[model samples]
Target: MKFLMSILLVGLSAVSCAQNRVSQTEFKKLMKDPSAQIVDVRTSKEVAEGKIAGSTNIDYFSASFIATAQKKLDKNKPVLVYCAAGGRSASAAKDLKKAGFKKVYDLEGGYDAWKE
Candidate 1:
């Protein structure tokens, strides 16, 4: 039981750690480079609620999310994605990376953290 608990804790922490995630400040810096593509992986309703300025909206839940991003973004460039509070963007970033995006970056703590 103790071994199982230890393993679970390690797995959970590894999942929660966002080594690939960058701060809003870092995202802004990355944006200055033409090789960065900024994306907001949130629904239109959430975007209507307000979003990161200059980010392109691609609904993460949509079946076309990956396809749309692939067509829109340069595969050689890094992808920087953010959702309202980070969760969706992280998932989307992973998908983007798996889909052959060279570099996938997520906004740590998402737009909420960025705004504040």
Candidate 2:
């Protein structure tokens, strides 16, 4: 049925995105490479609460996410994005890929997980 097919498509999309996420250890190793740009996609308020060091804040929910990301980074370079938890970062990673970023990564558990 069409409904079943739609569900299947959505499931597949989520799976593909999940496959793109990386663990905190992997993220830390990537940071050591220095070729990666780490991004925090949480809101200003969220950042005020606390954030991972070396991350640049560019709220994913903002109308200017695309513009801010463009200004803060080179579209061709590798970028790592994270939010308070994993949701927003995952969303941002998808957008970055659509925006022509060749290598984009999202923190699996986010800052909350990192802080622990």
- In model 2, where do residues sit more than 4 Å from their true spots? 1-16
Per-model clash counts, in order, read 0, 0
Instruction: List, residue by residue over 1-116, the lDDT tens digit for candidate 2.
Output: 99999999999988987877999999898888677899999889989999888889898999999888989898877899898889989889999989888888899999999999
Which 10 residues in a row give candidate 1 its minimum summed lDDT?
Answer: 12-21
lDDT of 2 at 93: 95
- Please list the Cα RMSD from the true structure of every candidate, rounded to 1 decimal place: 4.2, 2.9
Clashes of 2: 0
